[model samples]
Target chain A: MHIPNGFLDAKTIAVTSAASAGILTVSLKKTKAYLEDKQIPLISVVAAFVFAAQMLNFPIAAGTSGHFLGAVFAAILLGPWEAFLVMTLVLSIQCFVFQDGGLTALGANIFNMGVVGVFAGFLIYFFLRRLKIKLSISAFIASWASVVMAAGITALELAISGTTPLIQSLTAMVSFHCLIGLGEGFITVAALSVIFMARPDLLKEKAFSKKITGLVAGLLITAFFAALVLSPFASSLPDGLEKVAHNLGFISKEAPSNFSVISDYQFPWVKNKSLATSIAAGVGVLAVLAVGSGFFLVLRGREDGA
Target chain B: MGHSYFDRYRQVDSFFHRLDPRAKLLWMFFFILVVVLTPAQAYTAFLLYLLAVFVLIRLAKIPLKVVFKQSLIIVAMVLMVAFFSIFKGSLEQKLLLIFNVTAKAWLCLLASILLTASTPFELLLKGAQSLRVPQVLITLLSFTYRFLFLISEEVSRMQKARKLRDFGNSRLKHLKTIGHIAGNLFVRSYERGERVYQAMLLRAFKGEINTYSDLRFMQTDVGFILITTGIMLPIFIFSILFTTQY
Candidate 1:
């Protein structure tokens, strides 16, 4: 989401702008190491392509449509650092020329959509590939997760800025984005499948050095624990999981009052809560794959018939 | 493309247009910073800020309707945030939040719109470059600017073709067709990118882009900056005093 100028207070703007500036500086340096003479034009073209692609709307449901955000798409095609640069450029132009986003809030917008979206999406895809997931499936999951994660961060920023309460903003943002993520997942899968069919050569993967991979993994682990530690400040009220459990009448009357790990793993859908959670996750994965491939097959079949 | 879209009034003969792009950019930054940093309770100061912007809009001779339409997006966004504020505070606080957010966002947006409307995009980029922004960023902005219109034209053409094909009514089928169009656009852009690079190389292209500077700071620019600052500083002080008194 593109936060406007007045939506954030001075402290939030300063902190986010500084952080964005730092990250973009680092990205510019990283991009320079690999950006050859020929690749420069490619980067520009890819930036324009992402901008153009964003202008193309596809139907998501009856009387509703969504355009591509292109962060994950760009990261998958170009490298993450270059993708970051491209996103920043696109956002700047949208702000300066089109007045689509605010100038003062550009840093926050860039941080949320460009940096967080690209890195999280790329990391998810990287891990999924390591786990031997198919390319299209990984792309779908990555794109979905990226959008949801960006929304989460946006909610957090709004809450921290005191524009809204943490729990309310988080719940509203997350619930709405769950559906948007589905659209994102489907589009990413469909687009990637087409590229795979049409020009597989363009799908070259960059190999990160072992040291860099280790460093990234370490950073991610630290960030995860940091989030866990800070999560207490997110809301005094029950979290989404707990709220869902309570609403669905999953809490047992005879359950122990102590914070037990087993109780934490409870779900509402079935008697064996932990097993049900696992099964539900599996089923969700299967559903996404089925829908993604079904779309892919229909398109390929149409192409062949034509 | 219509001429009224980007840099619509750049060719107009006005005081704002004649000033150095660098000065206009500095003024924009200053105006935005002041508008954002002003206390939310400073209603008088905000009025003064709006009046100042109104004066600039008049001096620039751009149509009020154009500025208003350009500014409607920011107003809409502020209204959305204001609606969300209803879930948070008491009635008075909610009203205050709405007023503050709307005023600040509107003022900042108007300042930015004035900058773009008065200066050419190329001049803005040149001004940014002269300010020591990174070369890579400038390059990216220039290329994006150069091709954004062209790529958008290509996208519309593709949409027209898709319409002509009588695509199926099914939503799933429509999504697939859109995906195919995106794929084709990407492929075409990639090829075009390579050709453009080759063309540049043939013209003795180096890894760097060089441009000549013709920017000159005149006495009028200094007078404009001084007068604006003189008007804003007193209102800023008064607003701070007025805010603290309550």
Candidate 2:
């Protein structure tokens, strides 16, 4: 999802960069009035929590693992503006420290994942909540809707960058996200439900009624079965962005990334691409969780002990 | 406990690190322009761009391994994109096109990495602000960066608690457990946000945000800008003049 620097044209990068900067600045400024010195510790703690959660990609199908988008989680938790800021920081650290995203393309990434993903998801969640759906069902719908929309917007960004045609990109993004949305919906509902069970007061919304626990439980059971059944087909099709790239000329135009140690995970030692990708994905999850959890515990311990 | 990543090297004194972020930003913009404008088929020009990036990376003292690792993520994506092209396109055309993309992408990544490596992210934010970037955007980014990791940690704890209780049971059970963990984390974060907002309200926040940001356009910033332009301008001119198709 992190569009690296050279994959896009200069005009694309410049315009997006400028626009992203504008949006990011507004987000930052809007957060200031809400900032209190005491909240810093809590904010930092949750940010790390989001980061770690993203790392633990649950196996969605037989061969594929999907990570959390955190947009809904961030927005619902932090408010729309604040969520954008937290996500941007995650992306920056991911790029600079961990080398996860592109530096030159940071603006585009933040725009896609941070700004578009967070805000779109938040707004959708907001509207869905207003529609008077069951709280759990509303969360499920809102969370699913947000990620799907974000994915569509990302495809649009790719098209605007001239990497692929709009329809192809849109089709590809939307199709894959259809699957991702399931996982997203389940995660959102599950997380919210447990919190509803454990500390109902923390929901902060007056509308968070307890009557919907049965509905939430029913949804979770259904999603769990759906996930279990769908696991085999997760990687059956090419993702939306990739499909669009192929249909457009960008796939042909792409150079072999200079850093490929193993081409297509087809190394002689690891003959199976599936095995190789899964291993790498698993490693990434563990790495992110370990680093994030360890770091936060240390930080929190220090603050509490002080 | 080590939370800072974007600004890790900011406080470190260096010739390159002290340049104004806006100046550094301009340099990055121009550098990316030259790299991207060069047609993917322009192998010689691509080589030149790569060489230029190599020199800059060396000068900046960014670890080769680190840059390479970062580049690898993009390379993986590019490879995935070009995977079919390898089999489908004309051999030379595919090669040239792939080379153009991979080379240009790598070079551009290098340029941006250098910018971040040399400047603190907070200062980078301030630079954007001074450049008249919208306050809304900055506010969004500020909160994103600020809380990204915190939420990540909370999710981890919930997962740990789930795992400890479940102890690597059936796959279905594990999936359900994971889902529950995610739900709890979301609820916790949502509540924390309400508290944070209340805290903010107590601070008397207006719609607009003000920061104690200080930006100085020093001689070093000017020098850095001049040197970058001196190196990049010719390449940009040449790439435009002798445009090659890949």
Candidate number with greatest lDDT:
1
For candidate 2, the TM-score of chain A alone versus the native chain A is 0.64
Which tens-of-lDDT digit does each residue in A1-306 have in candidate 1?
Answer: 788777676655765676567657756756775554546777788788888888877665456566778788788877677888889888888888877777788988887888678877777787788799998889888888778877877776665555654566777777777777777777677777777877788788754323373236324533532352244333334443553564365544432211111123233443243334334433443443354345445544754696
Which candidate should be chosen as best, given TM-score against the real structure? 1
Error of 2 at A141 (Å): 3.3
DockQ of each: 0.25, 0.18
lDDT of 2: 0.60
Q: Could you tell me how far off, in angstroms, the CA of residue B208 lies in candidate 1 after the best superposition?
A: 1.3
